[model samples]
Target: MLLIHQLPPKPDYFRVKIWRRLQTIGAIAIKNSVYVLPFNDEAMEDFQWLRREITAGGGEATVCRASFVDGMSDRQMEAFRPLADHGAASERLPGTGKAPMNKRGRTWITRPDVHVDRIASAWLIRRFIDPKARFAFGEPKAGMVRFDRFDGDYTYEGDRCTFETLLKRFGLDKDSGLRAIGEMVHDLDCKDGKFERHETPGFERMIAGVVKRNPKDDARIARGAELLDTLYESFPAAQQRSRSH
Candidate 1:
């Protein structure tokens, strides 16, 4: 279920900063105060951390689950969160994809312009969730392509339209996470799913940890949304000068 978090009125920077961190824990923002995450243990803990962080930072918050009128949970909310971290960015690849793979999993990330191009990351994640999000091979041999998410043709186009085409092909059930989630995931899919990191960035793992600590809590879920947004926008570059601190 996608989680929604509502916080007391605070500076926009506070919200955005928190959002970026939450994404690292596997949460994605769907609304300004709402985030979407798959049903899993790790995601819940991540949400809880977000709630605590925001509260410690002087922001009041509430986390809740998002569901349609029919009450159907988001089907595409996935286990796609990557396993890397901020410190992990300095690690080097083994020099070849065919080299001995790790028992855990092969690493796949490079220096990302998260602070340089937020639009690109936003577009990438959104596309991954939407299924309709179209893809081109920044790096080939991805699972989606193996699953036939896109034809073997290149479509150098804007994210909005091309993503819609991809969604049409996947037959999107619903768009859960923050609107920006589509953008970021799609960006990763275009570039990293193969050559780079999976790009969920250890979010899924963190979330599972959360659930293990706490069984169920709506407040944590809402906080997860706030954190996811922070993670989503944190990339592509730091925010431009907004309200003075």
Candidate 2:
């Protein structure tokens, strides 16, 4: 699916809003004012909605199906693969409320080598989402809940890392400290510097040191959780409470 649009130049905020909507739907830009998403029912619906929004905002928009032949190859397309296949699986748990009680006590799986995002996500699951969340690093089983992996139940959404995704999905986004930590994790894990929080550099170095010192995933997650706990508490108590409400 392709969404091509031209917005009126006067209102700058409208342009940013449209861009963010595109990102939320996991659209990839191939050219200026042109974006691509995997041709699927969800993608088609998303593009249609964006087209309407653009047209209503005093913009011209078109949604169409396109075949990539000349400049883009299948391999390159794979690089920007859409989340359609995994979207249905992830929807089993909605973000409308708190983490579901039925989701507790399940083994969460991920890639063996734990890093900043995985460690933080694991900590989040244990600390807030599920106190008894058991983690395993290997091939996911039939009933295992996965995180940070491509087909996981919880993973990246648009530009968000797994930690940010989990925070948003589990109704934890209102907490200011968790939101700040999510920004730091996003900057470190995605390496995009979208949120260059002043604390991100130090957080990254500390996580790197944790990975270097801990050879096991369990140890890495344990050490990383301690760091994250301290960081979360470092925020002013009033600020955290005010936003959490």
Candidate 3:
């Protein structure tokens, strides 16, 4: 499915809003105004909704089925695979490719535009799982491990965010500070208000500032790691904090 759109130039916010909507639906951009997604029912519905929104915003929009024969390669086409199919079929492993569970010095790939859960998860990976982990942002590729995305080795399991998933998967859930931080990340990322920690608001603000100030993913991760480090130190174990309250 292709969504080609031209938004009115006056309301700059609308353009940003449409771009975010496209990102949320996992649309990949081949050009500035052309976005594509796998042609499935869900993808078609998402494109339709986006087309409506674009047309309503005093812009021209068209959603159509497209097949690339010349400009796009077979590997590039693989990027449009549905999110669920990104992983392997092996019961022992859940990532698109195989990597040792405790492997060090491997690149961790995730979706672009890191946010609260991605930042915290990256911090957890470096701080606990792999000290020398390298991070990359983009679609899943052969032999690259993924996280914080559909079918990733560590992704959302039920209501848990990637941060919480990583905590349990790596046997780090026993740490109190990590658990506390996970709760805050869960509430903020899931937007379910499950934890409602008093520090959540402040943490959210700080994360927003970090993302706003740091456009590069590596910079955001560096800045966010510092913030999470301070937060981890400030927090007692979950049980200790609960007992005090």
Candidate 4:
């Protein structure tokens, strides 16, 4: 949810900036000075950045998540394309504020000496998909979710990285900015002449620095997640660029 207010008779530039920012993140205006987007890391960060912008521009803003929202007409709902098919199995999901089945007691396995794809995938799992998810470095066990490794359920298929595979399988590819991030991860991981975002080299270098300083897998993952948050924040601008091209 988005809340915004400006010193009355708001400046036109501030108003347009807020609107464009929300539009970039695919938010739908629910009311004047209010907008909404599905709950996710991307949405949360988008709102945070907007809040800072608002405050800096002599306005007020607040963003929050709601467990329940109703009263949207069909047209309003059309603002966002359907994400995933919530099939019959989705009914078995835990109630709000609870961990889903995939996240509960699940051990995700990947190769040791984590790099771009593995670290980003771990960050994605922890940030968006699973809060209680645990990661280990090794071969896949009898009941483990393995990624970026051979013989894994969600390993690379052709040019895609494990992160891209997970995003598709999890029905999270709807976030255009995330798709851009996946492109960068794919190019950096496979180096297969795929995507060439200007930020790729610096991001990879930052990851290498983190890995060199923090030898532990868990430490590297934590540091990597921080970096991804920064990258994710920057992708919305790229989202606009991709649309123009």
- Native-to-model Cα distance after best TM-score fit, residue 122 in candidate 2, in Å: 0.4
| Every candidate's CA RMSD | 20.6, 8.2, 12.7, 17.8
Candidate lDDT values, in order: 0.39, 0.76, 0.74, 0.65
Residue runs of model 3 more than 4 Å from their true location after superposition: 1-100, 237-245
Record all residue pairs in model 3 with backbone atoms less than 3 Å apart, i.e. clashing. none
Query: What digit string (tens of lDDT, one per residue) describes model 2 on residues 131-210?
Result: 99899987898888988765557875655678888988788888788889999887666554688999888988899899
Give the per-residue lDDT of model 1 (tens digit) for 59-112: 665655545666334454454555543211111111111212121221222122
| C-alpha lDDT of residue 7 in model 4 | 31
Kindly indicate the candidate among 1 and 3 with the higher lDDT: 3
Residue range 1-245, candidate 4, lDDT tens digits: 45445533567865665565455456677678777766654456456655655666677777786644467644554457334211100001011122234655578888677877788999888877877888998767777876655445666543356788777767678887778888888766655445888877887789889888999888999999998888886767545755787
Per-model TM-score on C-alpha atoms: 0.30, 0.59, 0.59, 0.54
Better of 1 and 4 by lDDT: 4
Lowest-sum lDDT 10-residue window in model 3: 85-94
Quote the lDDT for 201 in model 1: 51
Q: Identify the candidate with maximal TM-score.
A: 2
